[model samples]
Target: MKKRSMAVMAAFALAAAGCSGGSGGANPSSGGAKPADSAPAKTEAPAKQVTLSYALWDKNQVPAMEEIIKKFKEKQPNIDVKIELTPSGKEYWQKMETAAIGGTLPDVLWMNGPNIVKYASNGMLMAIGDQVKASGLDLKNYPESLVNLYTVGGKLYGIPKDFDTVGMWYNKKMFDEAGVKYPDGNWDWNAVVEAAKKLTNPGKGVWGIAADMNSQEAYYNTIIQAGGGVISDDKKKSGYDSPEAIAGLKFWTDLIHVHKVSPTLAQMTDTTPIKLFESGKVAMLWAGSWNAIEFAKNEFTKDKVDVAALPKQKQQGVVIHGLANVISAKTKNPKEAWTFVSFLGSKEAAEILAKTGTVIPAFNGTQTTWVKSTPQFNLQVYIDMLSYSKPYPVSKDTSKWNNLETEYFKKAWTGELKIEDAAKQVATKMNEFLAQEK
Candidate 1:
């Protein structure tokens, strides 16, 4: 498996031809800011005719996302923005490394949370704090934690485009057929466990739930709700071994062993839990809002698949991942690229994303339609997630522990290691990695 950012491998076809710009980065058609209110029309210089290449990973999102680019073009007509999608997670990084090694990266790429910290520290990203301030963006509404995620050593590098949380994806038909009541937003983990038992029918090839050992999908909520965190405050240690965290990890591990309502982690490794849910092999899946588009487009139809808020653990909460639009440090047209990058984080862009149901926008209050638009299930889960959401863990070396999750988590999931033991091992390894960092 290629150990790299997911967005790195999505580089696709070259973008449509954009406005012509002089080889030297100067724009002949560059122009100005429009008059505001009754003030004399400001004769701003013409906007630069710059073409910026944007790299991303999701190919399925291209069609619906064109509208946003079109909107950006309407305002910044002189700026030609191209979208490039990398093919796979591994290849994305390989190709990006080739570019960076050659000093020819695209003007923009969807920066990853972990990558942002790494690149910014290496001076591979341009400071975006000034640009964000000039764009009149309300970063505060986006979530303070997210702002911190994209920031490294006190400087911002990207804008939080959209932040998403996980929820319990349940099969309504399964519930109805089993004569089990549907789970509401207020459902607790115990309630979910009970529902899982009632829904599981191994003889009929249906399991109550699919519990994959995914940090983002499975254990983050449990860890947080248990009042423990995946990493220590200073990023120098793992908190997985904490009393609260051990309790959390045990909850999921117990489901596979004691409860017997979900698949074992090994079973999930062969095929993801989501695939089980999609194939009608499972009754419930803890999924993130990012799945809304894929779930909506699922062949099973929206009726068979509905979403509800994640069940409460020791407390109410979910792990939220924020997708950000960041400019490449290598861009020659910083001004023009900034214009497009800022546009990507705007309210209009958020609306575009929400309307497409591709993602929950980070802009203030732009996700209302997205949540309500899908009528098959109450969309309130997206909103409900906000109150208890926390940013993804950040570090100078995120990969140090990113993969260790499943590696150590499987020990408990497989019954070889108690949750306490697994947590201790994970913490030990994570602390070693942190100690090695400057």
Candidate 2:
């Protein structure tokens, strides 16, 4: 799934308590009248029916999720589930925060790296570590990066659902028409520059690539490749002002300004980079594995496009991020919620998701089918990238600094400010925000 901007919510305190009561059997006939009565026959209580609300943002994955839910229902007949779809981005987080405040959040919902810390730290999500231990669920079945992504403050709050990494998507037809060699794993940043130069054809009104200013799909990968980072290892400071980070930022700026091989920020804003690629206006695009289905379904790109690993800079690097299934802290049906979430994290559910070709299932052995699902493209590149992938940077109040990034980075993308100047500004202000996170 594509990364979305999260909306900040004011923190609110909440407390929950559990109570239990039991009756002592036949409190010894103190009244004397009941001593002669026969002992009552024991009767078993009927199972309680439960309906769980599952909230998610991506409608495209609903079918696969439904299939999993159908299988879950066969095993858990008393627990029915309802799916609630909300458009991703600010709206989804806004609604979630509202639900958190009101204690009306769904029993189960999707969580991502950026907001996991915020929610889990605020006690808005249930910690599933104990449940995982009790169930004897081996987390080694999922990628270590993904398992770590959902863990906050030594507690696991979410179960990994799926993962995605960025790749270089190229239009084969454009490459053939331009007589340019196809990109491969061995290619480096210099190779991309040279190929882009050869691929750009002004007379045809086609740019070599769409170097859009996106984090996960663009600069974040470049930053790590350049041996810089978005945040410090401690997550307490910004690394944007470092020389390596500046070099990473310059990579895209040079693509737009120095070489003129990419569409300007304004041009991309008018027609998104994906649209440009879909319409054959750009020869190449960098996007997540989630775009495979859409590209395969698109008329222009279905047969003509293929994927390759992103070109290396100082070294090979890509940003890895994924979604997780988390339970709401306020959910009344905690037992049922855990049951459903635990099922969702199982190998069976991952296999079902892989078969849909919608995502790379986080479960290790299950991704093979997902790689095979889209045979037209080299979907395995994304899987291979996991070897050198870095986790997407995040902090407790990620949205706060994320907003600052967009604000300052846009100026650099548009050539309104030098890349170094803009990055430095972001680093300064981002550090200030980071200091206030607690």
Candidate 3:
């Protein structure tokens, strides 16, 4: 239950020894010309078998990943891939760091926005921009924001796999009990506020909504909707001190402090927003596209819940974030590694992932399959938001400032500090970090 921003952890992993500064690397050497006239017999040397470790953190997606690996072997009969699963969060990053230090990091692995800059900057990742160009892979096949997210210093380090956007999920059962109509496209911030007021039933211990301090699902979406940018377009300045940004932060704090519709920060300490929605303790949950698979499979939610695009204020907004497949710079089999990464980025591999309904595939046309995979809810809301989706805010070393969000935001969530005051403090510290990121 760490915050979603932590989904992309700090880039403090030490750089590996001898990593190339750029995508440059030695090509596989081919056999030399046959000896002049001494040939008695010619025999093709046996193909060298290679075993590559493919690391990923999501156990739920392992089956699909293995299916992709299985398809990869048909084309690469001499190469074998071993699945390496790691529980996400700190443990996974720590293990990755240890492997990098030992020069044993997985040949192919998952990458995210926060760590791309760190790894690419330190030369821990292989630059695949050349391979992508050589293969004629159209960057347009995926969202441009995603491509830009994984690129650092004009070098592309990863290829997008899947993306998620924020949405409002409501329990139809609760809406009916509260006599409030279900949310829809016509809804706006005022509509939500009005409905939430009618939906709260303290006697039943159920609140109208969950206004947790989750930036991705809550504040980030609202901030953008309120015409506030999280960071300057250049990534060199913090936007938290703007009046628009303060208004956005106050929106949620007001829900907890003035509106009395959302659970208190203390009340939510043991249970998360998603959990409250899942257990029917809350009417609505602000969540991401990633929740589709979980909601489809959960007995309580599968039958009673549905989703709608987030209500807007000044603008339509939601943060779009995705994961990419990348290769380790020190991988012994760069050719094979690229082959696997390439396959993961292809439409076929995307179809396999889409069938699981776990995420919205980055491949252009494969999203429809994911939408149809689940009929219980309107998954199209996620895809619809894509047109206006804003890339999650990031920088060369997002971790440097990402950690500071919880530190400063918690005070406001707990009502220990004024929302504007807390936001200004965060902006001051975030600006200090932005200035140092050369």
Candidate 4:
């Protein structure tokens, strides 16, 4: 599909980016004694109709997942399936938390890396080793980085659903107008800055970039470039105090406040950088491949918008995260619930998921066709990036720390706080967080 120039990306694409993902804690189903590995041990209870609720936040993919459930019904006509959507982003987390406290979480939940540790650590998540073994999901089949995200304390609590890596998304028409050649994977930070400067035409509302301030979006890449760890060896120290790390962050800070090539922090909060890019007000947005699905909307076909890996800093790396399917330890119907969870992790399910264009399925090789589902942009970057991808930072409180960075980052981005001061304070606060976590 050709990309759309000066065209608006479908509105949902922007919403998808802002929507934060989370899941609730779940206990084993009532009387759901952990079943034996061989066949699901039959229950002595009456064979009443069983309803399994699947909770997901992305409304866009709900339709596709529902289709899979329909197929599931063909196999087990007696089991009824229900679909529930948690409002996208933060609201979803709150809802999940409430469900967790109430012990009414859906039978199967979408699991993101950040909260898996928090939930699994609390013993709310069901152990999926038996399910994976039964479903024949050899942990070795998945990329180590992705599988590691949900594996804690030697227990694999989640089944890999899909994974995506970050990439640079650019507006093709803008590049042509600026007489700038398209960026290649080989481009460096200096090249990125130079390109952004040429792409700018503030008088006309076009800027070179929608500078991403999210650490998950930018700083993780920067940390790798700086050759510093996001956390120390003991996982109890902040790596932000290093000069290289500061320089890494300054790359974006300079682009906004100093170089004046992107919107200010306040501006970004109101109008997302990607929306600006899609609307032709900006030229580039660094986002994950999970987004490529929504960009499949009518406007972005045939080279109008496209993707490439981010310009290299001191290091060449990318951030990759996958959503997993985790069973709640609190589930009352483990035998029945495990069947659904196992089915979702099977190659058959991955194939269905791959067809939806919602995410890059985790069952390797199944993701090959996902990029082809989009016409507006080149999805090759995301595929290539996976080879060099690293896991997003993990912690018992990924929210507490990431939220801290997001809130304080605006200070540096808005020019209200100097970069050094901002980085220094961030380091201090991060260290303090590490201290408390310990």
TM-scores of the models, in the given order?
0.84, 0.87, 0.86, 0.85
State residue 179's C-alpha deviation in candidate 2, in Å. 0.5
**lDDT pick, better of 1 and 4:** 1
Give one digit per residue, the lDDT tens place, for model 4 in 1-438. 224311112211111122333222111011221122223212222255688888788877887798788876776666776888876756666666666655677788887876776667656688877666655545544555556667888888887787767788888889999999898889988888889999999889788987778765676776666566565656687777788778878888999878899888778878977677767888877877777766666364334778888777667877667788888787877767777776676666777877777778776656666777664567767777655555566555666666667667778888788877877787798788678663
Query: How good is model 1 by TM-score?
Result: 0.84
Q: Report lDDT per candidate.
A: 0.70, 0.80, 0.78, 0.69
Clashing residue pairs, candidate 2?
none
Can you write out model 3's per-residue Cα lDDT over 332-436, one digit (the tens) per residue? 988778777877887778888898887788776678899998988899888787777776787776776777788888999999999999999999999998998
* TM-score, model 4 to reference: 0.85
The total of clashing pairs for model 2 equals 0
lDDT of 1 by residue, 28-91 (tens): 0122221121121112223557778988776656865688999878876787878888765446
Q: Any runs in candidate 4 off by more than 4 Å, and if so which?
A: 1-47, 134-137, 298-303
- The candidate with the higher lDDT, 3 or 4, is 3
Q: Which segments of model 1 are wrong by more than 4 Å?
A: 1-50, 87-102, 133-141
* Clashing residue pair totals per candidate (backbone < 3 A): 17, 0, 0, 27
User: Which candidate comes out best when scored by TM-score?
Assistant: 2
Tell me how candidate 4 scores on lDDT: 0.69
Residue 308 displacement (Å), model 3 = 0.2
lDDT of each residue in 1-438, candidate 2, tens digit only = 112222323542211110100011111111222211312212122168989999987767888899999998888888899999886545677777778766688999988777777778877899988888777677766666677778889999988788888899999998998899899888888888888998898888799988898887898888988999989878799999999899988999999999999999999999989999999999989998888877877999989999999988888888778888999998998888888888888878888888878888876677779889889989999988877777778777777777787888899999999999999999999899889877
